[model samples]
Structure formats: structure tokens, C-alpha cells
Target: MKLRHAMVCSSNQNRSMEAHSLLKRQGFDVSSYGTGAHVKLPGPSLREPNVYEFGTPYKHMYDDLRRKDPELYKRNGILPMLKRNSSVKTAPQRWQENAADGCFDVVFTFEEKVFDMVIEDLNNREHKLMKSVLIINLDVKDNHEEAAIGAKLALDLCQELEAVDCWEDAIDDIVAAFEKQHKRKLLYSISFY
Candidate 1:
């Protein structure tokens, strides 16, 4: 059976989307989600928050941000990112509220907070429903550049997991390997921002 995966981050704009793209391109069954209350971004003024709800269309958000502050959107790479994101047919999803119909074989999160949230949610489920999923958290920053690197790390780890026979039975060993690789990547890579 093919393994199903999910990638999660704060806004579902940067890290999770990047990983989703890479994993899908590699022919893995993957989905991405955000854990934020609403989609949030740096807007025209640093003080102004650009927020969109879970179901808001990416193009709409892009256009609104462009209208609000063309210069700020352009400078932050939000315009191009939104353009690409729009093609993916993704809307923001709060992890706590969006229950999975079918459990994922593995779930990758971009930060500790998201990891904790996922763990808590899984813990709340029945024991049989929780035992099959493996959650791995990679400590990547919420920036475009770091997202790109995180995608690479996620892809490598997924590919490694794919090669193993009965990976579900080897969860602990696989997670340990993932953590070691994650740490090695962080140590070798330069500063995120």
C-alpha cells in the first residue's frame, strides 16, 4: 500500500506548501494544512496584518494585498508566492478543527508548536486511531528561503521512508533517523534570514 502524508505549518503559505509541492512532484500522496487562526501575512505597513479565513481563495487574497500595498507585497515575495499558491487550490486550514477522514501514515510539521498541536489532537482520539500515524517535526523557520530548504529536507526524509519495508512497524527507528537528518541539515545550513 502507498503511504499517505501530510505537511503542516503556521500559515500554510510557505513551509507546508513548499513541502507539499516537492512531495507531490515526487509522486507521493500528500496534503498540507496551516495551524493559524486565520491566514496571516506581513501587509502594507509592518503593523498591519493581512488575514484571510480558511476558505478564502488565494487569488482574492493576493489581489487584496496588492491593492492594499503593492510595494510591500512585491518586496516580500508574497505576490509571486500567492500566484504559485493560487494554482495549488489551497485554502488555509486550522489543524485543530479540520479532522482527517482517513488517517495519514505520516505527518510532517514545520515547528514545535504545530507538532504539539497534532500530538494533542491525536491523543484525544481513540487509541486504535492514533497508533498508526507517525509525526515528525522539522525545526524550520517561516520564511521563503527556509521553506525551500525545509522542502528539500522533507523530500529526502520521505524518500528514505518510502524505501523501507513495513515502515509503520519501524516508526521509532524512522523518527530517530529523521531527527538526526533534520539536526544535521540545520547545523550545516546557514542562517535562515
Candidate 2:
């Protein structure tokens, strides 16, 4: 079956967007989201993060950061990331804030915490459709390099799932094989929408 997919992370700036770009290019019906209250990007110090509201356009972030510290943002890769994000979508989206009209067939989260948040959000919503969504978590560090790696791994898993006749029936075997091949344990939970 052709599945609708969503990639989720904390801030929707790094990991999710990375996978979002890749999945969209590969022609998968995909969307991305974050569970954070505010979109946060790395700043000059660990204690200080450049924060923006969820609806703030990525282009604004890109320009704001460039104006703040062109050299630093460029060196840290935040500028490039914002540029890519702008190209993919208008702005960062908050998963919790989005009362999504439709449900995804499969949702992928880059961290266990994110997975928990997604599941919790789904549980809190009314199950009007009664459609089950497979939520999978693969722990990936919140960094540019790790995001890239995780995106590719996510794509691999998506391709594998798409190759199967019925993912719901073959999910167990597919997840097991994927774990064995990638040497990464995945946590999955099913929820209705």
C-alpha cells in the first residue's frame, strides 16, 4: 500500500527538515513537524538559543541569523540549514499545535522523546477516523551530520516499507530486518486518529 509519512523532531529545524527534504525529493507523500513550543536554533552560546514562533517564516530566520552573525551562523551551518528549510516549507510547524485534518499512515521520529510526544498527542486527540498510524522512533543526535545520516536511514526504511505488499502485515518482519541491518533498535507504537 502507498503510505502517507511524517518525519518529526523537537524543533523541526534540523533532523525532521533534513529527512523532509530527502523524502520529498524521492517523491514520497511526506510532511514534517516538531513538538516544541518554539523553534530553537543554536546560537552564540549553549545557554542562548535563537528562538522564533512556530509560524515564523524560515526566510526570516535565515536573514535574522545572517544579520546577527554572518560568519558564526555560516560556520556553524545554521544559515545553510535555514535556507534548505525555507525551500522545503514556509515555516516551522509545531506538531502539538497542529490539529491535523488527516492522519499519516506512518510517522517517523528521530528521538525517543519525540516519539513519546507524538504518541501522546495522538492519544489526546479524538479518534474520529479510527485509522491506525505506525509511529517509529530511531534515536538520532540533533546535529547536522547525524541528521543527514538519520535522513538516509529513514529513506531506506521507507523504501523497504513501500516495497512490501502490505506494511501492516509485514511490519514486524520489516522492523526486525531493519534493526538487524542498521544495528539500530527502533521503538514503534500504533495509535488511532
Query: Highest lDDT: which candidate?
Result: 2
Per-residue lDDT of model 1, residues 73-127, tens digit only? 8888998888877776656566666744546666787877777777777766666
| Runs in model 2 lying further than 4 Å from the true structure | none
lDDT of each: 0.71, 0.86
- Clash list (residue pairs), candidate 1: none
lDDT of 2 by residue, 92-184 (tens): 888876736757888889888888888898898899999988889989888999999999998898888889888889999999999999899
Off by over 4 Å in 1: 127-131, 168-182, 185-193
How far does residue 42 in candidate 1 sit from its true spot (Å)? 1.0
Per-candidate TM-score against the hidden true structure: 0.84, 0.96
lDDT of 1 at 28: 82
- Model 1 residue 43 CA deviation (Å) reads 1.5
